[model samples]
Target: MVAAFNRFRLFHWLLAAFFLLAYLTGDGGELLHVWLGYGLIVLLALRVLLAPTKPRGFPSLAPARREWRKPTWAGVGKWLTFSTLVSVTLASVLGLGMVDNGEVVAAALPSVSIDVFGTRNWLGGLGDLENVHEFFANLALWMVGLHIAYILLFRSKSVMPMLRGLSPQGPGSAPKGRNHRQAPAWPALQVSSKVQETPDSCSFELTPPAGEAARFAGKPGQFLTLQVPCAEQPMARCYSLSRLPQPGQPLRITVKRVAGGRVSNWLVDNLQVGDSIQAMPPAGAFTLERTDADLLLLGAGSGITPLLAILQAALLHGEGQICLVYANRDEVSVIFAGELATLQQRYPQRLQVVHWLDRRDGQLNVPALVQAVQDWQQAECYICGPQPFSELAGQALADVAVPEQRIHRERYSGVEPAVAPPSPGRPSRVQVALNGQRHTLDVQPGEVLQDALDKAGLETPSACRSGVCAVCKCRVTVGSATMRSNQALSDRQVAQGWVLACQAEPDSAQLQVEY
Candidate 1:
């Protein structure tokens, strides 16, 4: 079902086939051999001349200076690739010079002859050139074999990109006007300030470089994806914005250390002021939907970060009353404690703040949550916390007969679970309408919908391939689908048929979707 064939891939396949055939038929002096040589010459020329015109077409055969110093596996691969290209080119040129018959392929085309070490005869004096050609040809073949083995053994995922001209987890170069949102550019934002909110938690203020603040502007409750440089590879982690968005102000994110959380621990213990980190633009569907509605916000532990932004935004822009139920293990574990107290004092009549410390009040269970929110049952509820607390709050709301559509929950984990590919079976049919084009795809059971579209060469916008970013959201128009996990979409959005493609799995045999 993977069908990402394109002109570049076609050229690559043809050139590979021609090179293999020509190498095998070396020195045959037959019409087929001569024609294959000519084909290789033409294909190689086209590839070299047209590479600059294609998107990221030029291969980085040579490693960068830093890469040479570091000597990573990537740099070694580049060296091997460069060696293969050089060997192939040299062999092809030698074969052209070794051609001695003018009428081998085309009578009108004159045969190419070179006097190497005073040689003119094909077998008598030019035997040395043939030996050299054979050396380079064999070297090219060996280099190619090594490259294939390296890919199969170490980077099996890379083969798909070569065959399809697109990476499985990367954004593709879709045609313009195709309704595909371009991938977010990761720009390095400097850390302007840092604050230790709690013993195991800290808040950092990140400011974009000069003239780029507008790109980071985001609605309250949205989150940013940070690319953390780990020891082995760069890790992408999502952190909710903890402060209200303002022009020319640095964005704020609170990080709470989680046991064995690599990114979180690194960020808390290592990140310093004046350092820079790459970040994607803010994205999430947890923003306040209606500022005018009475709001009941529920949060526990570090989950209060995003809810604080929402509460602040609501208090600043809306006339409706707002109440926040914040739970924590103890008084010292509360993040933004001072700020919340200050806001409560300033807006005493409009904002109600309730803090529940488990050390004093025990855990916030379903019965307790129901009792706490009984007075605010008519308010629109927004909950963000650990899975257990969020689920308990949701259950309490359901017990109170609050409409499901009015309750929204934001749930995410420090570590994402591994998603296995679907078991082999008959795939369901999916009819997708994107950018005025209709296409059909066969989706395997339990397969993520966004991945299916990617294999089919559709370049839909996506990031965080986990369901946290909501960058790959789409609407199902015909059949039904279920999400494996959802941290982005609100209950209202889900009810309205919006599904995050990265998390959606087909629930019916036939379905229709539009982006």
Candidate 2:
């Protein structure tokens, strides 16, 4: 699901190559030009189908908080991209029509008969069509030139993200220190044991047959993507490893029931010891590197799962002092409460556990937090929780003058997307291409892409409809669209023209999307 957006890199490159090839091999190189034109048409159609479902990345053109501020370059880029798509599409259509008129087709070459404009009256009746075709072809060339220049002038730095999927890690952007190998295939693992940590939370120990621990061995703070075979479709969910990996102990993951979570409740109610389930190797960015700096780990609810692993690993490695600020609804809801107490008892001088109960303590006081730890700003901080908890904790850390780079954060629930307002326009048509089939959807003035696609009966990959997951990402080949929010895609990914389909809305009269 996370990898869906990156898959378009090949298509993007191929489209550009084909466009250049077709342009370079004109009538003089009829065969080459003709073949390239056919390929370009197919590719352009695919792009049109993908436009409505484009992956929404971090928008460069987000609106300013103050309404008085002028529009951003991203706003201008939206129109420019749409114009480019329209012009290019026009050019491709005209070229195809001209070829079908038999002007460029040779007797010896294989040709497709698709004369939308009858060839019998080419010069007499089709003169206007030929002229319009030539005009759009020229306009497309100009648009392509301007588009390339715009990217070079303003978004030159984003070239790498277009080729690769990830944003470049600057210094101190959360330490992802573990060297990960290629992800192994999902293997069936038997549930060895289960321990109920709280009324709504439980820990499951899963082990593969003997000699499989090495494949499953993962760094602390990484998560497992579990495949649950539900009654409908197979569902996949990520869970953090709650314990540090050991030689003989099975891999353990903790799960807390979400209010209306289907997978979580199913796992808690249906999973039993000796039952086999599928799981992939661990993967995530919320990991702690072995450092000498004292650590301040903050967690709320089941967010403690990853932090617990980090704490145990740090203790085993003989790191500096560690302080944990764990928050829960009450004492009963605290996961790993006994384990945390045991660790604190064993490392009296090194570990400090501050358990805050929401029922009694209310919100964490920033000044009190600052005063609680000596040299608090100096310690490397890691925070995990639900979206609100993580944000509030991060803000508090900032108020205490902790370096922005020093504080790291992770969230168990997906974050909401951040989106710029739609470029001023009303789009009416949305076309989708999926699994070699094309479907057209009528989009209302304020309708989003996902809704239109749904109404049209095309179900694309999606989780966290808010755009935190890139599962519903598709490519925009024609027209223009805007996303409401996009937390999952990096700025570079946005620059490459990906938009999250779930949050997307057409910005032009017609849009095409391909997945």
RMSD to true structure for each model, in Å = 22.6, 21.5
Cα lDDT over the full model 1: 0.77
- lDDT, each prediction: 0.77, 0.69
TM-score of each: 0.61, 0.51
Encode model 2's per-residue lDDT on 1-515: one tens digit a residue.
12334445446546755665667666676566656666677766765565443223212122222212544555454446567667867776666666544544444344644443356443345577768877887787777788778878887886676666755443212223231122224588899998999999889998966676776777788777777886486666778889997777888999888877778888998899999888766655566753335789989899999999999987765346888988888989999999999998887878899998978787665665555544667777888898777777877788778876567776457332344444445557877877677888877766778777777666566544555445566778898877876544544456667787878877778888877
Stretches > 4 Å off in candidate 1: 1-176, 179-182, 231-233, 290-293
Q: Per-residue CA lDDT of candidate 1, range 1-515, in tens?
A: 11233345456546755666755864463556656667777767776775443212244334444455566664566667667777877777786677654445335444543333243344445568878888998898888788778778877876766666553331211223555545556789999999999999999999988877766788888888888896586777889999998887999999999988989999999999999999887777677765556799999999998999999998775556888999999999999999999999998888898899999999778888888898887787899988888888889898898777678777767665568666766788999988788999988877989889888988788866767667788899999999987767767678899898988988888999988
Best by lDDT: 1
Colliding residue pairs in candidate 1: none
